[model samples]
Target: MTFTRFVLSKRETTLTVVAGLLTLLGLAVVYSFPTWGGLGGMALFAAAIAVGGFPVARHAFRELWLSRSLGINTLMVVAVVGAAIIGEWAEAAIVVVLFSLGEALEEYSAERVHGALEGLLDLAPPVALEILPTGESRETPVERLAVGDRVLVRPGDRVSVDGVVRAGQSAVDQAPITGESIPVEKKPGDEVFAGTINTSGALEVEVTRLAADNTLSRMVVLVQEAQLRQAPVQRFIDRFARVYTPAVTGAAALVAVVPPLLFGQPFWGEQGWLMRALQMLVIACPCALVISTPVSLVSAMTNAASRGVLIKGGRYLEALSRVRAFAFDKTGTLTEGRPVVTDVVDVCTCGECPEDCGLQHAASVEAQSSHPLARALLAEAEARGIAVPGAQDVTLLSGRGIKGTVNGANVTIASHAHFDEYVPHEPSVCRQADELAAQGKTVILVQHDDEVCALFGVADTPRASSRQALAALRARGIHTVMLTGDSPTVAEEIGRHVGIDEVRARLLPEEKVSAVAALAEEYQIVAMVGDGVNDAPALAQADVGIAMGGAGSAQAMETADVVLMSDDLAQLPFIVQLSRQARRTVTVNIAFALGAKVVVFALVAAGLATLWMAIVADVGATLAVIVNGMRLRR
Candidate 1:
């Protein structure tokens, strides 16, 4: 955050400063006394090279002898030695000085980017306000707080652990974790993550995860791991560099020996090809080409991670760039995954219970179940302050519904299809259920004994950002598909609302995987985005799997190739844009690096370029590509 923090370590800084001063002094002496031509001028340049170039030369020797590897350091040291042999001390000193300065600049830039990431880690407070059972609070280190420990988050304070709010209502600003623009309302039982700020009210939250296991910590770890992962192009460059350095060295040797020996030029004359060979050696360093893709990938990945997008590796970023279609799960992905009671209609004409008692009977029977529809019914009953009596012998009829005994009467809550089996004569109730199903609402027929009690309609609403996200994908010419266990009517209704191009409904977990495979076959690349345990299969089956981390299950996160650390669907488009930009930047860098080297190589071979010109071309190309790659970090 300060200028001093941007300064690198004292050792490196001192080395660079001392080397720069010596180079400047050497240049002053050479230019001021051009007629010296003796030991005096040679001593000045030699001092500069010894002081400024020793690090590079020493590294070159170590790598060459220990690992038998030829790299940029080897190229630089060889170029310097060849220049000295040809009595070109001024050029050698300048090359070493410029190379040293470039390394210093690279080190500073890397530190700055890493410093920005460290800022994210500092957002979490080291201590927490632990609430004690004796009605007292104590400040405790975050590391000592175990799971289930109660922590009180005061207004405007950052939440220190991931947990469900035990009490109190407040608006939490989750922008740091989810990139959400608006503050989210949280109350008892609602989940809140670490590093999120509590905007209003005091909240008592029971810790659900340890400090090191929080979402923010996981994001940082994943990004660090991602940076270490090599892309396909980067791996190829690594292999190429292994062969490239020695090949260029051989080419330089041939240039030094072949022309002077065969063409009969005086070996030690000014017109000799030895000088040209050294220039070619300097020009063919390949520093720019080797660094082109990785720097860009690192910058882009870090930037995306800071914005709540976790691209697991460079390969996934490459895959994301090629994605032509995206498949999404319906529940917990497109929809809110929480059903609300939409309509409660009267279907009881047999007078088994009072007309208004239909909801009470349904609520009483459903209170014993934990299904989504049952939760909706219980929630509605609680909101209306209706008393739900306890039920006995509650039984789950898998794929159908529940049957129980409530208040000494047999009660059955089942899907519309089973309504006829229980009440075969109730044609009127069946017709009403059909009408509600046509409107994309799930209808549950409530029966008391053999008589129809009521019909309950439940529907899960789509997320606010789903439509915009799908529209953005379509604008980019990428297809969007919806895969869900919901029936055709419900799936199509939600898919249409979200502008999805295709809908595959009533799919089991395995069927969802098949759907992703089919999409992959149709479009060479497919990305699947989901936020549930059931979605793990499809997510893994897709070419690129993206999980919504905020609401997603742990299994989905582990199985996904990329994790959107936020619930915001807008991250979908942002991810696509970032991946494409990274790929484009890398392509341009490769082309520019290779093209510049080829042009300079031609100039050097034809004796049209001096050693100074070769150094400028090589180092300048490297600096240009580095700056271009750093642009993504913005």
Candidate 2:
């Protein structure tokens, strides 16, 4: 019963169980028959070979045939034949066993790379807490839940759909999806995504999207979609192994046969030349070299998942290490997109009451126009609760500013360049205006009763982390550059704030692409990071495009090789480090594989290595390379 239980286990355990069973059976048979020595010997040999040779044969066959082409397996076959011709069947069998064992190890290592991403399929609940008409509660299948359904999400539960708070407030931990460690605070009308953990406080949420379109489904789809993409071209060694294996095997066959026949040498001797040829065949097995890369790749992936860096594949991993220059957009990449009013400037003084004059003139004139600057001024006035008097016969001068009459006072508030023609008297106001403009602040001049009053300064400020991240990147020897659509003054101001070394301003979309290409010539490799539609062209051209995936457009993410799961700039340095580590690992695995083969080749010619030893060497070499590559996961 114990023996039966052992035999019913998985493949990894079968070898031990079968070996024990064969040993016991052989012993029993030998005791029963006096001539059982020969029979027992054969049984022992078959059991040992089964425990050894079968695996190698299976692996070599799969690697040779299952592969897109037959290169490596053909070599192993030739080696086996040479051993058999020299009466080294046991040695040949051992070689096959070692080769197969190495192949299995490689497969297992490759499996580690994609071990994360538990399909959120099961996270979808069968029933939802739906608040129906008349405020009655109903437990309906999540499938029945549609847009606008108010789902009552309890504390410590995942939100069932992407929705806004129709009633209550709660906190949601979005780490599972966004890789953000902090739990986001939510309030009414705030859109909470599905699959995010509802941390504290129970809340009612109105679903704005169906279950299919929810974040959970989208994440699963994205991961799956990413998988369907092809990996970068296989590493060079693996490709070489394809042609190398078959050619080596064919040569070994010719060595074993042609030499014995032409030279009239006996098939088997104390030192069988055929045996030497077989050993030579065994020495050429590239299993270790081939398995080395995939194993490392898989292990690296598995480790990275634990840390929330869902690198799509090994190719992207390689590309990340090679990025030399990083291109960034200003509005969101380096600064908070939320702009606020900072200062006001006026070139012309509205005698005695400068404040009211500029406010009255600029607000009235800007109210007539429909530009962002105009809106900023209007919003500022509204926020201050200033009762803006009616402006009469407001005329918007195209490409300039605006003019009108506010409370019987002639008001003309325009861009500083345009206002120069109308308001001219105050040198202090002009200096203040120039200072603000130079710092990248948008300054709007105001003039009432033909006197300049004030200039409103508006600008998007840099985030606290942006400066720190820039410094850290610079410390790591990476050049930090800013690409902006703003004027040179504005670009310089923002560049100084963030400690960026280079700034490219006033670039059109096509120009940005050309700039990146030109820079690529001097730089080792470049990574383009941007959030807007204007950045699409350059992002596609980068060696490794790091898109701000959360705020990023679909086109940007699709074009980029590596997408920052969150807009965390700190992850930039971390990714670059990861790439460096992965590249080193790849090199190490390659070296290990090749080094093992070289040693085996020497041993074979020296006649110190047997077929069995060759098998062990091949399996050991393959296993070592795979394990080495997996170290990148660390």
Per lDDT, the best of the predicted structures is: 1
Per-residue accuracy of model 1 over 582-628 as CA lDDT, tens digit each: 99999999999999999988886576888878888877888888899
lDDT of 2 by residue, 1-634 (tens): 2323433444733563454455455556656676856466446645754674444456557866687455556567666655655545455545555565455555455444443444345555657789988887788878788887888888998777778887777788866655678988888877777667888888788887687766556555555554444335345665687678668767776766786789886557536667767777667777766666555555554454444344566776777676677888887778876666677544443246634457656777677777777777777777777767778978877778788888788887677667777767477776887887888897777767766667778888786778888887788788878887878988898899889989999988788888788778978688888763557788878776666644224454455666565667777787777767767776787787778878887887676877778778777877777667767766
Candidate 1 RMSD to the correct structure:
3.3
Q: What local distance difference test score does each model get?
A: 0.83, 0.68
Cα lDDT of model 1 overall? 0.83
In model 1, the Cα lDDT at residue 517 comes to 90
Measured with C-alpha atoms, the lDDT of residue 269 in candidate 1 is 34
Number of backbone clashes in candidate 1? 0
Best by TM-score: 1
Q: Could you tell me every candidate's TM-score relative to the true structure?
A: 0.90, 0.79
